[model samples]
Target: MIQLYDSFHQASKDLYYSLTQAGFQGPVVVINDDGFLPEGVTSAYSYYCQMETGQGRSLYFNQLQVPPFWEITGTNGDGEVWDYSQRKAKIFYAEPKHLRRIKNVDWFGPNEKVRFTDHYNRFGWLFARTYFNAEQKVTSRIYFNQAKQEVLVENFMTGDIQLNWQGKVYFFDNRVELFRHYFAEMGWELSEIWYNSLSTPFFLSYNSPEAGQDILFWQEGIQEDIPGNMKVMLNSSHVRTQRVLVQQRQVYQKMMDILPEEQKAKIAYLGYIYPSLRENAGRKEILILTNSDQIEKLEELTQALPDFHFHIGALTEMSQRLMAFEAKSNITLYPNISQKQLQRLFQECDIYLDINHSGEVMDAVRKAFEQNMVILAFEQTIHNRDLIPAAHRFDASQPTDMVMALAGFAASYPQMVALQREETSNESVTGYQQLLGKEER
Candidate 1:
C-alpha cells in the first residue's frame, strides 16, 4: 500500500495520523518537498536527493553559513539574516524556537529583490533551490542529491522537468509525468493506493493499472456542487477509485445531498481521531494564545465574567498595554511561554478564547480543538473558521452575547462539550477500521 499526496499541509497531516491510528501501514509519498515533514513521511525531492534515512545534522540559523559580516536575528515566527544594516535573507523554521531547525531561506539581492530560495531538509542538507525572475515570478528550481549534485531541474515557465539519474538523461513534459516516473523507479507494487487530493494524486491513481483499489480521502471543502474530478471518481467505473471519504461532516452531507443514490454508495463521512487531552474539572479557566495584543473586547469580556479566570500566553514578551491586565485579579499572563508551560495550560484550561487578532501562533486553534477545549470567538477575530463552529461565533460588537454564552457553558460544561464535539464530528478508530475493512494489526 502507498499513501500519496500533493502536499503535507494540516489536512494531509490529519489524514496521516488518522490512518496510522486505524492501523493502516503504508509508505507516504508527498509530491511537494517543503523540506519540513513529520517523521517517516518522504517527499519526491528527498528520493531524488538520495537522502539516507536518519542522516545529516539539524540545520540552525547560526550555522547557515552566511557572509562573514551578516548577523542573524530571531523572531517569534522566523529569523532575519542581515548584512550590516540591509536585510540579506529571511530564515524560516518548521517550528520556531522549539525545533530550532532551518526549513528554508529566502535570499534578497540588490534593492532587496528576491533572488532565490534555498530549501533545507530537517536532516540539515540543501536539497532544493528555486530561482525567481526580475518580475518576482518563479523561473526554475534545481533539486540536489546528497553529494550536492544536480539530480533534477524544473522549469516553471514551460512546466517541464529534466532528470539526470545514474548516467542516463530523461525529460518530462510536466510534474505529473515526473512523479509517475519516480513511482516507477521506486519499484513498489501499486496494489492499494490511499490519497488525499483530487488533482495529481487523482490523475495518477486514475491512470495506474497496477493500482487495484484507490481510496481518496477528500480533504478539500465543497460548496453547492461536488467537484468535477470527485464526480468522475464516484460515477465512472473505468477509474480505480473505489471509495471517496469526506473528512468534514458538512461537506460530506452536501455531497450526499447532491449526488445520486448510486454515487452515494461510494462515499462516506470521515473525521480525524484526535487524542483527547482535556479534563473536565468545572474550573471555568479560559486560555488565549496570541501573537498580538489586539484581542477584541478583552477587557469587556474579562469584566463581564468576574468568576471566570482568563489565562493569556504568548511566545514573546508582552507589551505594557497587555501587561496591565495583570492587575486584574482573575487574569493571569504568561510572557515568553515555554512548550511545557503551553502543554500545562492546554490541560488545565477547559475553554479557549479565539479572540486574538494577527496570525495564529503555533497552530493554536487546532491545538485547542485537539485538547477538547470549548473554543469561542468573535467572527472577526477567529483565525480558523473550520474548527470553530458557527454557533460558538458571535459578532464583535456583541460582547454581552459572548459573555452570556460563556456563562452558560460554564454552568453546564459537559453538555456544551458534547454538543461541540458532535458539531465538529470528531471520529473514532472504529470508523476508520470500517472504512478500511480491516482489523487492527
Candidate 2:
C-alpha cells in the first residue's frame, strides 16, 4: 500500500473522500498527536506509539525505545529494502493486496528526522513531509551528487530538488498557471504540488487536468473568500483539513436552509428587499470603517437606509467608487481616516459595524469596548471567539433579530460596561512574542 503523508486537518477527509470517489478501496488511517477526531470516523487513530510491520504476509514497522534507529519488516517476501545509510526502510510489493495491516511499531532514533513514502499519481510522484522533528529545524540545504538510489543522512537538509536521491522527490509549487506551464514543458507526467497562503511567490500555480479530474485536498488557513467548491472537481476525491473545513462542509446546506425555494418566489412580492418599519433614518449612528472591497456593498446598504447618514473609509479604487456612490446618495465619505482619526470616530459613534472579523478591527473593538461603546458584529468564528462577548453578537441573516438586539443594547447603556473594560485589559497574544521569545530579540 502506498503511504500518503497527511497532516491532521479537515483536508484529510476531503482527500480520503476523493480517493474513494475514484474507486480506490482501502482502509484509511487517521493519526494525530491528540487523537481527537470527528464523529462517524472509522479509521485507526493513535498517539504516542511507534509504527512498523509485524511478521507474516504482514507489514510491520517497530518503534524502538531509544533513538538512533528503528526496524520495519514485511514477512512473506514483500521485500525488505533498507537504506541503512539514510536510515529509511521500504517494503514494496507489486500488488498492494498482498500486504496486510500496516502496523505501528515504537521507535526512537536520534538520526531519523523526516521520513515518508514517495507518491506517484496520475499527475506525477511527489514526496511529502510525513513526520519530522519539531525541535530540529532542518536548514534550507539538500545534499546529493549524481545518484538515484542512495540518500545522504544529514542533520540539516534543504535545497530545491526536483527529486530526492532515495527515489523520492517533489516538484512543489503554489501557482496553478505556472504549474501548468511547467508541467507542459516537462512533458505532462504525474506530480503533486504543495500550496499555502503566504502571499509570497507561492499560491499561483495549478495544472488544470485535461481530463477535468482535478481532486482538491483542502489545505489549512484557506479563507472564505475562496469558495468551498471553487477548486473541488465534481465526483472527485476530497479531504478537510481543520475546524474551518467543518464549517465549509456544511456552508451550502446552511445557505439552503437560510433561503428555501418558496422564499425565492416571494422575494419580489416583498417590494423593497428590506421592510420600511425598521428602515427608519438616523435611528442610530453607524460607524463603518472598511478596507475597500466592501465599500459598494456598504453603498447599497446606505440606499436601503436612507435616513441614516454614512461615514465611509476605504483604501482602494473600489473604495473610491463607494465614495462616488455615497456622494450621490448624500452620505459622507471619510476616504482615508488615519488611525488616530478612526479612534476618534469610534469614540463618537453609537454603533460600530465592521464588514467581518479582522485583527485590526478586533483591536478597534477592544478600544471601543473599553470606552463603553456598543459594538455589533456577526456570529463569531474561531479567529475572534476570544475577542467577542456573547451579549454584543448579532445574527448576519436575521436583520429583524439583529435590529432588536441592537435596540436592546442601546436601551441598556453601559450594560456590562465594567465587564467589557476588564476583558479589554486582559493579556493578549503578540505575534512577535509567538515567533521569537522576548529574550531572543
Candidate 3:
C-alpha cells in the first residue's frame, strides 16, 4: 500500500498512523515540501525533466492540468521509464482512532468528528481523495449509502445520539422530510428520530404537516422567519408549493399558531441537553461573543468594562477592530480556538456578554448558557432575551441602561450564582417524549 500527503499537519500525521496500522508499508510520498516527513519511510517528490523544462504530477500531455487518474510519462533520477498506469491503488483516509486491523472485516463509526488542520488546500485535496475512496470502508462517506441495518436518529446538532462503535448508527438530522427522503433514496428504513429544541422552523404553505409517524419531535417556542440555510434546504419542489410563512415573534410559536390543534400535540415546550458540568467558581472575568456584526460594539464594551478583565471570543478576526481592542492590557483576545479550548473559557469565566446578535443564538452563547454562566445579552438581540433569563439581559438600545445594569450585576455577583443554581436547566421544560404507536404503549 502507498500513502501520499502534504505538509506537517495533524491530519497528515493521523493519516500516517492510520495507514501504518492498515498495513501500508510503502514510503509515503509528499507532493512538494519535505520538511515534515516521517522519519523512516517518507520522501518528497518534485518534478523536473532531464531537459531544461519542468514538470508537475498533475500537468499532463503538453502541460495541461488533468486529474490524478492521468499519468505523467517521464524518467526519474534512476533513468527508468515511469509508468503511472501500472500503479493501481485505492485511496483511504481513516481517522487515527477509527482504524481497524489490516484486512479485518469489522464495522466502524462514521466521520462525525472532523480533525483536519487549517490548511484548506491540503485538506481539500484530502477530501476529494477520500470522497472517491468511499467504497473501501470510508466510514463517514460510505455509511450514508450503506446504513440499512443501522438505526438512525434525529436530534439537534449538538444533541446527536450516541452509537455503539461496532455497528449501531445514531444519525443527527435537522430536517424531518428531507432526512426521510434521503434515507428512502439510500434504500434505508427511516427507523427512529428524536428532536430537541424547536430551533428551526418547519416551513409550510398551508395548515398541513409531515406524514411520518415513526418519529418524535419535541417542540419549543417558534419565531416568524426560518433560518436562511433551512430555507435553502427546504426548497425542494415537493415542499416548495406547500410551504408557508409565519409573521409571529417566535419560530415554534408560529408553527403552533398555524397548525391544527391536534398536530400541535406532537410538540410541547420540552427539550433536553447533556449539560456542561464544568464549574467556574469565583472568577471575576467577562467574555464577549463577537462575529462580523458585533465588532464595533466589542470595542465599546472593552472600553465600558475597563477595570475588569475581558476575554473576547470571535470566530473571525476583523483585523483592524480586533487589533484596536487587543491593544488594551486587560483584554485577552482568543481567535479561532478549538472547541476544547473554548470550553475551557466557558468553564472559567464568571459572566458572558453577548452584545450584538443577528438572530440565532450562537453555539458559544448557547453552550455558555448551558454551563450556567451569567449571560448578559443585549436587548436589541431580542431573541436572546427569550434564551436567557430577564435578570441576565441588558437593553442594547440604551447605553446608560446597559452600563448601570452591568454595574449592578457586578455588585451582586453572588446573587447571579444563586439564580443560576436554583433555576432548572433550560432544556428540561422543553417537551420531549418517546414516540410510541397509535396504541400509546
Top lDDT model:
1
Query: Which regions in candidate 1 have their CA more than 4 angstroms from the true location?
Result: 52-54, 96-100, 167-170, 260-262, 439-441
Displacement of residue 124 (Cα, Å) in model 1 is 2.3
Candidate 2 lDDT score at position 216 = 26
Per-residue lDDT of 121 in model 1: 82
Candidate 2 has its poorest 10 consecutive residues by lDDT at: 267-276
lDDT of 1 by residue, 231-263 (tens): 777778878898888888878888888889988
Q: Which candidate's TM-score is highest? A: 1
- TM-score result, candidate 1: 0.91
User: Per-residue lDDT for 299-341 in model 3, tens only?
Assistant: 5566676776888765544466565667898888777544576
lDDT (10s digit) by residue, model 2, range 1-441: 111223334345444443333334433333221222333332111210111111113222232122344444554233333445543544333222123233222122446533443321111111112333545543432222222222222222432224232354444332233233334543533333322222211222222333221122324323444343433322223322111111122333343354446422211110001101111122356676554444223544455555555555543233444556655554666654556667666656655554433333324554454444555566642123334566656555554544555555444645544344344323222322332123320
lDDT of 2: 0.35
Runs off by more than 4 Å, candidate 3 = 1-215, 218-268, 280-282, 289-296, 314-321, 327-329, 335-343, 356-362, 379-386, 389-395, 410-425, 429-441
Residue 133 shift from truth in candidate 2, angstroms: 14
Off by more than 4 A, model 2: 1-284, 295-309, 315-321, 328-330, 356-362, 380-383, 416-441
Q: Least lDDT summed over 10 consecutive residues: which range in candidate 1?
A: 92-101
Q: Each prediction's Cα lDDT score?
A: 0.85, 0.35, 0.40
